[model samples]
Target chain A: MKREIPLFLTAVIGAIVLAGFFVPHPYVSVPADYLQRCAVIVVAFGYALGGANLVQVNLEGILRRHPDWPYKLVLLAGMGVTLVFGLFVDRAKFQDPGTVSLWIYDHVYVPMNSTMFALLALFIASAAFRAFRVRSAEAALLAVSALVVMIGRVPLGDAVMAGVFDHPGLPEWMRHLRLEPLQQWIMDWPQNAAKRAILIGAAMGVMATGLRVILGIERSYLGGSD
Target chain B: MTISTDFGVWIAALLTLCVFSFLYKDNPLYKFAEHLFVGVSAGYYIALNYWTVVDQYLVIPLRAAFDGSQAGGPFQAQMQDYRGWLIVPAVLGVLLFTRLFTRLSWMSRWSLAVVMGVFAGLKTTGFAQGDLVAQVQASLVPLWIPGDLWGSLNAILFTVGLVTSLLFFFYSREHKGVLGGVSRVGVWFLMISFGAGYGYTVMSRISLLIGRFQFLLVDWLHVR
Candidate 1:
């Protein structure tokens, strides 16, 4: 009965959501928006559960005298310290001001994130060197396009290629002709097709899941009903 | 000003150093900073949602429902008629929490069903127009090109690339002689597209990391 009910509900709800899109009535749309808002809250709660799980697993490792126990302790300490500072620290007059959370976010988080990203410039250069071999026709096309785009982005390319200029140079022509046209073609064709395909797949998945939930075919959430 | 600016600069330096520590095999201080980040982030979201959505929209208005004077609550004064519908969602939101209780868990579906059905209905027509119809329309092009040999060949290859790639994804048919060859070519296009997409994704993530570094160096530390 428990399983059957969920499956039935999922099917019905799935159909309703699909139907609601075309129905064009406030009766359906309003309810759907409200449900979506509630889902966000529920998802937020799920994140809380995830945070709790992180603490629990890490703390357990520390208590068990695991080899990497010090790292686990560091993790727990970090979590605890941040939680304390955010929840308890005064926002208005912290000397450093802008809420303790914001202070951490702006000063600590953003810089770390940017530094990590800057490291990618090194990785990209290395990867490009490895990928630059002319093995296939497609490879040659990619190499040429990449080189043009890279050179076009810099001032040095224009200085070196100045002899080939009809007022503005080869870089300008490449940008307008090769890069712009290619970008336009991609936006016009392939991206659209892929997006539609993905949307259809996602919509189908949502319908199937909704049906399972609404029709009572899926009782995974019901915690072993007797 | 000096004190506040100095503190900001110091904290920014600490964050920068902690982040860069990852380059030198992960260590204790780095782990500590990472966890602290997650915990603080969670708390902020909780506070933001409770303040902005729940407190502002739900709880205050529900209270106003009982207050006989129909006019003077914070939200009721602002929104008026829309305030009543808050009950429906509030009830549904509460019902979601009932998943914690085993016997009454089935009620959560009422909320889920309503949400999914409505979004799908709302999005279908627009998604079809924007993502499907427009895309297929753009794919169609005139075959004749007047100017040059290279231009004509480029146009032909581009058309072939677009159509064959689309056909390669078709699950309904078995590809046999010519169709098989076209589909094989389609696979190459898909690989390049995937590779390019992967590279772009990597670039985006790295850029985000660089933004963080720049923030620390320029804004926080005031380092040129």
Candidate 2:
């Protein structure tokens, strides 16, 4: 009864949402909108539950006296402080200057996030060095396009070109051989085409997966225990 | 270098240093930052979700269903409207909290079902319209433009590239003969796309990296 009811509910919700999309009548849309709103709230409940799960797992680690339990304790303390400020202290949620929650978000979260992504720059350059070695025809093509894109995107490419070749003396066709235009052409033509094809493929995939999910065939979200 | 004296700036700088230490090796400071990041983000997510969606969508409306006004009493919505008929979902949402209890965790599946169904329905039609139809429509350009040689060549190349790329992903049959050749061309286009995309992404990251360094130098320390 437990699993069956869920499957039935899924099918009904799926049907109604799709119907709302196709039908466009108020009778369909009103209920559909309401259902979606309810879904959002329910999903929020799910999110809160996810947080509880995180806390639970960490608390258990602490209780078991795991080797790195102190880190878990720090994590809990951080969450507790942040939650108190966010949930109760700043319940109004306006970006008031006095809100400690906002301050933490700006000072702690945003900079940490920025620094994390900034760290990726080093890794990406290392990857490019290994990838751009150009061992095969396809790889060579990729390397050339990437090199062109990287160079064209910055002022360095144009500066180098201006230093090496005088634009005034260059012929009309030769002037068009600038890396900027060349990269733009590659992006507008081949890249656009590739993106379109990839999106089409992805859309087909989404359609299939969505349908499967709707029909409850994909039950992986329902854990194995029950 | 003149150092930042503001406590918040000092905290941010120290955390940034802790995070950046990963370039050398993972240590206690890095682990501490990583755990704190996870915990804080998760906590924020929970609080934000609860306060924003569940309260706005569930609690207020449920209140309106009884008292004919939202939680704060400023906004007045008629309780009898179809929108107020969220009782079933409210019940389901409460059931989701049952996940915390070992014996009643199975009840959470019902809420999960509703969430999945609606999202799946939304994404299916959304992708159909935005991705498939739009791209296909855009690809229907004039294959042969008169008088303009490059335009005509570009149009032809775009059409061929798109067609071959689609064919390359078609794994329904064996890749041999004409299909194989077309697929091979598709591989070239895909490779170019990937390379260009990576190159573009790396440059953007570098710009961000530069921004962080600028912050560290100019904001945290009065050095350039």
Candidate 3:
């Protein structure tokens, strides 16, 4: 019953919601809506479960004197401080400016988030030199496309083009030689088509997967137990 | 000549520097900031979820239902009626914690099953309606525009790209001769898409990096 019950629950719930889309009756719609709400509540519990697991894992690591235990200690301390400020305080204080939560958010989280993403710029440049090498026609196309986009979409590209080529002495085509229009054409036609094709294929894939799950054929989510 | 007087600015500046120090090498400062980030993020989200979902959806509805303390006039009757049904989900939500115990872990599957089922069902119809149908519908543009050569060419190119790209994903049939060539064109289009995407990403990230530098120099150091 342990396994059967949940599997039955899956099939039943999935059928109800899927039916609601076609049937549009209150019996299906109402139950589907209720199931969705339950899912939200359940998901919130899942988040709390995740947070607890993180705390537990970190605590265990520190207890065992694992590698970077001090960092783990610092991690727990940050969580504790943030939680105390977020949860133990009054609602007004928690949400208001100058609060400890807000202070940490502003000073710590914002800076870290910004800097972390900003570091990606450096990493991407390093990666481009490594990954964007041209050894074949395909590779060359990719590299050229990237270069065109990099130059076309940015201000620096305009300045470089205008400085070097944008002269009255140059031929009309050469004078009007701009990366932006070429980039735009590439984006509007092929890029957009690729995106739409992927979307359509993925939608079909999702439907198939959903059906598989509802049929209980995809039991990967259930784990190996019973 | 002047450093900022605000302690928050000092903290933000130092943290930003600590993160930037990563460009040199992964060091203690970056590790510290990274760990702190994960922990603080968890706590922040947990608290936010408590306020937004748990409190708003489950707790408040259940609390008011039990306590009989809702301001009632027109919508009160409907509000009070459905509030009682929330107990079912509240019980299910509690079931998710059973996984923390080995013996009780299997029970958590009950809650997970519901979550999986609802999402799968919703997404099945959602993707079909929102993505597949919508995209295919939008792709059906006029291929031959009179007196608009470029427009016609663009439309035709779009149709060919879309068809060929979809064919590239068709694995049931062997790709040979004509199919092989078409799929090869699809591959090129996909490569262009990826290249453009990467280029766009690099530029945005660089812009953000510039913003960080401006903050350090112009905002903090007064040296800009």
DockQ of each: 0.27, 0.65, 0.69
Off by over 4 Å in 1: A55-97, A116-226, B1-5, B68-126, B137-159, B202-224
Alpha carbon deviation, residue B177, candidate 3 (Å): 1.7
lDDT of 2: 0.83
RMSD of each: 6.1, 3.0, 2.5
Per-residue lDDT of candidate 2, residues A191-221 (tens digit): 8899889999999999898899888798787
Q: For candidate 2, lDDT tens digit of each residue in B58-103?
A: 7776675577454534333232243456677788888998888988
Name the regions of candidate 2 deviating beyond 4 angstroms: A128-133, A165-167, B68-84
lDDT string, candidate 3, B1-224, tens digits = 99898888889899899898888899999999999988888888888788788888888878777785656521233412457678878888889888788888889889989998999999999999999899999999999999999799899999998998899999988999999999988888777777877777888888889889998998789785
Model 2 docking grade: medium
Give the best candidate by DockQ: 3
For A129-163, candidate 3 gives per-residue lDDT tens digits of 98666887767767777788788888778777777
TM-score of each: 0.68, 0.92, 0.94
The window of 10 residues in a row where model 2 chain A has the poorest summed lDDT is A161-170
Find the 10 residues in a row with the least total lDDT in model 3 chain B. Answer: B73-82
How do the candidates rank by TM-score, highest first?
A: 3, 2, 1
Write down the RMSD of candidate 2 (Cα, Å): 3.0
Q: Which candidate number would show the highest TM-score if scored against the true structure? A: 3
Could you give candidate 1's per-residue lDDT for residues A72-153 as a string of tens digits?
Answer: 7765665565556654574323224557766666665555556556656666767868866878776764555445444443
* Full ranking by lDDT: 3, 2, 1
